[model samples]
Target: MKKNIYYFDNSATTWPKPECVLNNLKYFLNEIGGSPGRSGHRMSIAASRLIEETRETVGKFFNYDDTSRIIFTKNITESLNICIFSLLKAGDHVITTNSEHNSVMRPLRFLEKKGLKITIVKCNRFGELDIHDIKNSIVKNTKMVILTHASNVIGTILPIEEIANLTFKKNIPFVIDCAQTAGSVPIGINLGKYKNCIIAFTGHKAMLGPTGTGGLCIGKDVSLKPLVFGGTGSKSDEDTQPNFLPDSLESGTMNVLGLAALKASVNYLLKMGVDKIREHEKNLITRFIEEASKIKRIELYGTKEAEKQASLISFNLKNLSPSAAGLILDKKYSIMCRIGLHCNPNAHKVIGTFPNGTIRFSFSYFNNLKQIDYAIEKIKEISRIE
Candidate 1:
């Protein structure tokens, strides 16, 4: 194994987080160790303030004003599960794309077995979704439109704005999985208008926060039942769940330490500006794609254009299984990346890489052209391995 590691797996979780995140985590652990919304002590009040401030920062980050609707979860998977299991009933119909992660698919499939109808609109091999496809798929009974803002497998960005507009006109709930784009790309929904939209985001990825931190920015028009019922500290006198925005969804002791770090991370993003980070990652993707295209055995996937996708690229080296190549990349070159179907077999099938998936390089703002060049060089060397 090589000593120096070049991380290209931001889509999974971002490593080398900003210094502020770590600093805040330490600060919370050392000083403010109390459960938010659970007590009246000063420590508890401080913890609650951290969470509310983090909620406010997230609201400004997403350009949404309603901070009370921001509900935190352990990860985007939980946020998505809350949306899927709470909003849709047995007879309800939901629309999603074939490019969704298991977070969306698994819950929907679970409901499908119980009589819920699901429509998976197929995207092009490049993972590009046509907004018209979603429009055409909408039915009279369609209760929700749930899909990813970007494909976790291919890094292809979907037309969420158009889809949100369409769903808004139809008066249907629109759920967006922002796991891959939350910190890297600007979330394009104007909540004032598209009040039916729900954006699920994770903190560990591009947000540069620690794991066990993620949340859902709920729209005004959308109301979901509590997925986990417990003590929200509010309406604790009643045993039943609270019929409110965040309290309705958030039930338990909030992750105050994680939220403390998340607040710092989001503050960092707001300070650095997401557009600048996006531009840097786009440059990495553009350079990687350009170099990888020149390699003899490399078969690039997705749109092969930086502008068309997120900050990641998927490709396969001819005569090399993704698993084998990934192992070699890890052991020989210290290049960390994700391979195989990336937990989304539907996306792999769409791109004709099912069973044998492509090696995915998910870049981050911290990654640069030098790392991209090195990875491409390593891939070139790996391609020659007979």
Candidate 2:
């Protein structure tokens, strides 16, 4: 970790994860460093227990009673690919928003080239999309409605609850990409919302866990064909993949250490409360918007209203490239930010900054108002150049 760096790029990945989370990682490495669901050894059983406990807690987090259906994966991208490739056929169509991370867009684009029809609904210049636009985009052959809960670039929170209702009413399956809002905000979807929807999330970003940890909260009604077929710990005699939840998606050795850390992080979030975490980030964004708005050369993107956003802000300086601004913030101001399209070309196009991307500052639970104020001062000082 950089000693004096102010991390404002948490939307890409969080920093200074809770001590409990780190302790859990240490616990895994020290106490139980064995593969989950593989052997009958005590360490292996302990690993399995950790994974199960995390799944149950996550189920409770989303208000899902059945934890068995919670499938683990490498991250949101792998989870989305599992659902997309498993469900969508060659002639099927998928409807999604204009502001999607490459995690969703990349798989959809690859599937599109492989003969899957896709219709991307456009959001406004502020990265706001209307539910009616979704209704307008739906066609007879549409199979899935993939949604990004919040824009990674602009932090605009979408109307997912309404969209979930629409998908249920139309008997369409929905997949929400929760990469930007998972642990930082209050979202109790997956099993609580529409039964036909699947929620994909990563642990490293908002969940505050290590990388190589993430999964999909698969709903009761959705049955996905396994993308990776290999040996499951259960029914080792059978050559085919087992028809179970984690076993179905998880083929190779499980990341018990990572899941142990994730369990600790999720527990910490449960203790602090998602609402409180959300409020903290909102305060940071509010101060960020309030202070940065005074800079004459800076044009901020996303919803001007801080209450309607996640924990991120996107903006551009007049005449100064986003790369240059980010470099200056890093080298000169000791600040960090994400610069470029942010893996969402469609979002940039919608926000009218396509090829040249905006500088994105994503917030996390650990960020404070003082950091926000400092970042704002740095931006203003940088923009005052002759």
Candidate 3:
């Protein structure tokens, strides 16, 4: 809401989305107001075309070609829940990492209480996970493996390809929560090689799209039961839910307005290139870490190496709570950042910042080195406080 501040909280949800996203959303409201797949009228057909085109764009962005397998949801959390709950049941074993957000952890924990077995592969304090740990944790009953593509708290990118390979060999379904990496990092690079992987992504974080827009780029090998069932505009004669792609998983009416903006946002990403965006944000991370590390009292978390992480950095000043520093950065310096566990307490525990979490500064493609310099100066002043 406050556009005047230096926004560095892109990991939670990207702010100041691309101008095209806003423009297309306006166009959808003004020009195309119809429910996709629910009607055969001109406006409905136009809206359906937008959704399909956006699906194709998302599939291309991930290097995944099967657009039908991509099922839309409100967010990555819902996507992850559908994968976790639908794929696993009692007596089944699931594997995950310590760097996962609660989206993946909560569902697994709930299933664990219902007679499901869970193996939490531990990551190092740097939030780096070893693929060997995942391999060794697998058993005959291991049904699914769910984890985050990157740490929401420390911005550490996990060894996704390696883990996906392991799961493919084990014939286990691998569900990836890509809430932090969807538009900022290139995903599904190995989807062709790994058939058992499902990538759940949110549109708000790095995709430059509005909230309430996300979905699963499901692999051919994975078949999930519908998490929600309702009118899919098909098979109307029968009360039974349709057993197919997209429609089967999508019950309610599609978010045509949000998808119109998402279509524009992802097209913009494709044009700008995710790799280019990654490099730009990497520069910002490198600049901020280089200067923030100079303050002796500041305790930086994660691998500090810009290449090994996403565009976020977490730190704590000696004798200063993260909340206090966050307030000073917000009220005094007009810098917007996230503080506390960042919805991933396990990550904070892995990085030894549990309970009282660290201050997080997440960057985006729009961020620059000059903004990093200003944030560092403010952090330096804040660290000197008693």
TM-score of each: 0.98, 0.97, 0.98
Better of 1 and 2 by lDDT: 1
lDDT, model 1, position 312: 86
RMSD of each: 1.4, 1.3, 1.1
Runs of candidate 1 exceeding 4 Å displacement: 1-3
lDDT of 1 by residue, 1-386 (tens): 23378999999999888889989999998899988988899999989888999999999999988898899999999999999998998998999989999999999999999999999999999898888889999999999999998999888998899998999999999999999999998888998899999999999999999999999998899988888998899997898988987888888898889989999999999999999999999899889988889998889989998998898888998978999999999998999999988999999998889988889999888888988899989999999999
lDDT of 3 by residue, 298-359 (tens): 99998999999988889999968999989989999999999999888888888888899999
Candidate rank order under lDDT: 1, 3, 2
- Report the Cα lDDT for residue 310, model 2: 91
> Positional deviation of 172 in candidate 2, in angstroms?
1.0
lDDT of 2 by residue, 1-386 (tens): 45787998888778978999888888889988888888899988988888899998777766777787787888888999998889887789999988898888888888888899998898888878888989988899989999899999899899888898899889888999999999987775646557888888898998888888898887777888888888778888888788877688888887778888888888888888889899888888898898888999999998877888999999999968999989999999889899999988888888789899999998888888888888888898889775
Give the candidate number with the greatest lDDT: 1
What's model 2's overall lDDT? Answer: 0.86
